[model samples]
Target: MDTRALSVFLSVAETLNFSRSSELLHMSVSAVSRTIQRLEEELGQSLLERDNRRVRLTGAGQEFRTYARHSLDEWQRLRRKLGSDEELAGEVSLYCSVTATYSVLAPILETFRATHPAVEINMHTGDQADGIARVLEGRDDIAVSGRPSQLPQRLRFLPLLESPLVFCAPSADCAVREMVQTVDVSRADFDWKLVPFIVPERGVTKDMLDTWFNNRGVRPRIYAQVAGHEAIVAMVSLGLGVGIAPRLVIEASGMADSISVIAAPRDLGPLTVGLCSLGQRLASPPVKSLWDVAEQTYPRAI
Candidate 1:
C-alpha cells in the first residue's frame, strides 16, 4: 500500500472531514479525497460514507483505522529508534549498590572505563529490589545484585561472587567479645541482642541474618535497624549494635579500630551475587562486550 495514501486515510478517519485532514497534512483537499478513494479501492470496500456536506467511516474504514494507526505509530517509533542507536555509542548505564564499589566490581568497572574511553558509563546506586526493578523494566541494561528469588522470564542471572556473612562487634574487651570469637549468636552475652545492630534495608544480608536465626529456630532480639553498609559500620564504630556484613564491606571500612569481625559460623554460607539482564537485550555489540567482561571478572570470585 502507498504510505502517503495510508497516512491520508488515517488522518481522515480521525477527523471524519476530508478538508480538515488535508489542512493538517498540508495537502490539497482534492488530493486527500483521491488518497482515500485509492485506499478504499485497494481494500475493495466502501471506506467512507460522504458527500459535500458530511463524511463518516463505513465498517471497513472503522476496521482499517486500527491497523492504520498501529502501522504509522510503528514507523515513527522505528525512525526514533534508529536515531537513539546512534546516540548509544557513547553511554552505558550500570546499576549497583553503593557497597559494591568496595569489592571486585569496582575494579572491573574501572578497567572497563579505561578501555572504552568513548563509552560513558553511568552508575546508579540503590537497594537490591530497586535495582532488580530497574533491570526488569529495561531502565538499566545490567544490574549487580543478589540473584532475585524469582527472576522474570525475560531475564537471566549470572552468579558472580559468594560473600560470607560475618558477625562483627566492637572489640573493646566487651563481654560480647567471646560470643563473636566463637561465631556463636546463641550465647547470652552477644550484646547484639541488647546493643545497636546495623542491617541492610532488605537485601541478601537481611536474608542471611533471618536464615541464621530461622535454621536454629531462635527469635533474635532486635536492637536497631539501620540502612546502608557504611552506616552500619559507623554505628558499630560508635559502640552501637553489632553489624553483620559481607567481608568486603568490613575490610574496606577504615574503622577496624572500633569494630572486629567475628568468625562466621560454618553453617551460614556466603551470599551469591550476580548479574541480572535481559537475554535479548544483550544483542547490542557494546552490551555484549560489557557482558563478556563482567562474566569474566565476576566468575573468578564465585
Candidate 2:
C-alpha cells in the first residue's frame, strides 16, 4: 500500500472527478487514472463508478475513503511525533464561506503564516452552514462557523466574534418591499403571515429563525429556502422576499445597498462566529498551530 497511491485515490474519491483530482494534485489526468486503476486492481474491487457524465464512488469506494482518511491522519500524526523538535510542516484543511475568507480568516491566516511558514493551508470555501459537518466528517481539520445552539459533544468551538442575526427586506420599490412597508415591522402586532419570507435551508441561522417564528406564533408565508447568507442577500436585493441572515454576512455581501434591515419585534440573539474542530484533531501539531494562532489573534471571551 503506497501512501502516494492512497493520496491520489483519496483525492479522486473526494472530488469524484479524475480531472479535478489531477488539478488539485498537480498530476496529469492519465496519471490520476492509472493510480486509481492500480489501487482497484490490487484491492480486487472497483472503487469508483465512472460514466461520460459523472463519476461516483461505489460502496467499496466509500469504505475505502474512510480507511484512507484515517490512514493519512495517522501517518501525519506519526511524522509530527517523530520530528517533534523540527518546525511543524504539513497541511491543514480549512472550510469557510467566501465572506469569511477576507472578513474572518485574513488576519488569523496572516499571523499563522508568519509563525508557521512551513505548514500549508488548504482552504475550501462554501456555505458557512456546512462548516461544522465538514469538520465532523474529517473532510476538513477546521472550519469557520457559527456556534450552534446545542454544540456537538465531539467538537470544540473557539468563539472569535459575535454577529447579530437580522431580518432584511428589499430597499427597492418592489412587491416585497411594498408588503414590508405596509406594516410597521418593529411592532408585535405586525402581520408576518402576509410577507413572503426567504429562509435558510439549514444551519445555525435557520435554527434561530425557526425559534423566532415559533415564539411569535407566526406561520410565515415562505417564498424560498436558499443556501448561503450571500445568496439570501442577493435574492432579497432583487426584491424576492424578506430574509434572515447574520449582519456580518449582509454587510459583506456587496448587495447591502439594495437590501434594507427590518426591525424585528423580538431580539434575535447574535451569532457567535468562531473556529470549530474535533477535539481529537486539535492534538495534531499543524492543526493546533493554526488554532493557537487564531486564539492569539482574536483574544477575547468565548
Candidate 3:
C-alpha cells in the first residue's frame, strides 16, 4: 500500500541489484533492503535471493514483481497527472437538463472546445435534480441544474446563467398559438390568454413559473407536467398544449422552426441557473477545466 516501497521494489526487480536500485532512487542501500524486507514480511514470503555477488528473485518475488511494477507505474502516472492539473488536457464529463444543453450551455461549450482543443467532453441529459445527483454521486464532473436542493456539506454550487422564462407553442396549428399576443410592457398593446401547460415538476424554476403565473392572476389549465425540457419541446412540436420553459430551452431545442414564442403580458422574469459538483471533486483536472469554461462564459452578468 505504501507507494514508495512499491517503487523501490519495482526498481530493485528491474535491475536485480540492490546497490543499483538504491543509487537510482537516491536512497541508501540499507533503506532499499529494509523496504524489501518489510514488503516480504507483509506478504508472508521472502521476495529476493541474496548472496554476495548476484541477486535474483525468489519464486514469490517473481509473482509480486508483476503487480508491484504495474502499481508503481500507475501511481507515478497519477502523480504526473495531478501535478499538471493547471491546464486542461483530458476528458470533462458533465450532465444537464436537455434544455440547458441547447439553450444555456451551447456557446460555452463551443468556446471551451475551441480553447482547450485537446480536451473532450461527455455530456449526459437529465432533469435538474437528476443532473445534480449525477455530479454529486461522481457520475459526472459537473452538472448544470436549475435547482440546488438542500445539498449536504460536501457539495458546492456555482451560479451560472439567468434567463427569463418563456412559453413556446408549435408555429403550426398548436392550440395555444391563438392565445399569444405581444404586449408592450409599459403600453399594454396586446392581449395574453391562460391555457394548459407543460412545465418541469416542482423545482426552483418550476416554483418561479408558478409564482409568475399566480401573480398575473391567470390560471393555467394545469394539464401536463413532466421533468425534462426536451420532452416539453417535443410535445409542443406535436401540437401539445402550451409549454413554459426557460428561454435557453427554446433556442437549444433546434425545433424553433416548429415552435413560436408566446409573448407574456410581462416577462415571466429570469430564473437563476448554475453548476454543481461534490466539493472534494474540485481537484480533478477535468472538472477544473469545465468549471473554468462555465465561469468565463457566464459570470453573474447583469
Each candidate's TM vs. the true structure? Answer: 0.62, 0.89, 0.58
lDDT of 1 by residue, 1-302 (tens): 35676767766775678878778779999999888877877789999998878888888887886576456445544655777544223335578877775574676776676666665565667665466677765557688877655668998787888777777888776654544555566453444444445666676567767877776666655666766666777777666667777676677777767888765766777767777778865654456567777787765745
- Candidate 2 error regions (>4 Å): 84-86, 264-266
CA lDDT of every candidate:
0.68, 0.87, 0.70
Lowest lDDT 10-residue stretch of candidate 1: 84-93
Question: Which of candidates 1 and 2 is the stronger one according to lDDT?
Answer: 2
For candidate 2, the per-residue lDDT at 214 reads: 84
By TM-score, the candidates rank as 2, 1, 3
**Worst 10-residue stretch by lDDT in candidate 2?**
262-271
Predicted structure 2: clash tally: 0
Name every residue pair that clashes in candidate 1: 196-241, 197-241
In candidate 1, how many Å is residue 208 off? 2.6
Ranking under lDDT, best-scoring first?
2, 3, 1
Looking at model 3, the pairs that clash are: none
For model 3, residues 32-111, the per-residue Cα lDDT tens digits are: 99999999999999999999989888889878965764564455458666785544454556787767776678888898
Model 3, which residues run further than 4 Å from truth? 1-91, 102-120, 147-154, 179-194, 213-219, 265-267, 299-302
Cα lDDT tens digits for candidate 2, 59-123: 89889987886776687778766876667676788999999999999999999898889887878
